[model samples]
Target: MGLNGQIPRCEHIDRCPVVEHGPPECRACLALGQSWTWLLVCLSCGWVACSDDSRGGHAKAHYQETDHPVVAALEPSSTWRWCYVHRRNV
Candidate 1:
């Protein structure tokens, strides 16, 4: 299924203000000089941030901060996405 249909009403979608600029800057990853590995879809407010700072820990932080779970690799080649809370692929 396409993302539109696969991902139901992600609450974060409206709350996410980062999408306005194409892709939000990977704040967590930029600090570490490591390119972002995944696009963390905020469950609380769909803010797409880079995974972890040094490879995608920020994504986990979002999970830690908010119970919302679900993240996808920003890589175009990747179609696999995961939900941390659900502990399953979406």
Candidate 2:
């Protein structure tokens, strides 16, 4: 997560899965019991995955494979998101 503020609309905003499905969809947590340190929601397809700080860093892998740049934090009350393409929080 980065500074709190309004996130400018980006190209992936329409397809971001976080807007459609919440973080409970994390497959890594369901399948591997991976802890959700900084839970991530795929912006490309909405597939939730654990953060790099978690057991598998599946979130990063998801981006590597899918090239989906934006991911919303799954923690309660957190509205922070990251952009892999920009290498910073958007």
- What are the per-model numbers of colliding residue pairs? 8, 1
The digit string of per-residue lDDT tens for model 2 on 3-71 reads: 587555555555565346554756867788656666787766777888888878888999999888888
- Candidate 1 to truth, TM: 0.51
Model 1 clashing residue pairs (backbone)? 12-45, 12-46, 28-53, 29-53, 51-56, 52-56, 52-57, 52-58
lDDT of 2: 0.73
lDDT of 1 by residue, 5-31 (tens): 674544433343443222566675677
How many angstroms is residue 27 displaced in model 2 relative to the true structure, after the best TM-score fit? 1.4
Error of 1 at 9 (Å): 15
Question: C-alpha displacement of 69 in model 2, angstroms?
Answer: 0.8
How big is the positional error of residue 16 in model 2, measured in Å on the Cα after superposition? 4.8
CA error at residue 31 for candidate 2, angstroms: 2.7
Candidate 2 off by > 4 Å = 1-19, 22-25
Least accurate 10 contiguous residues by lDDT in model 2:
14-23
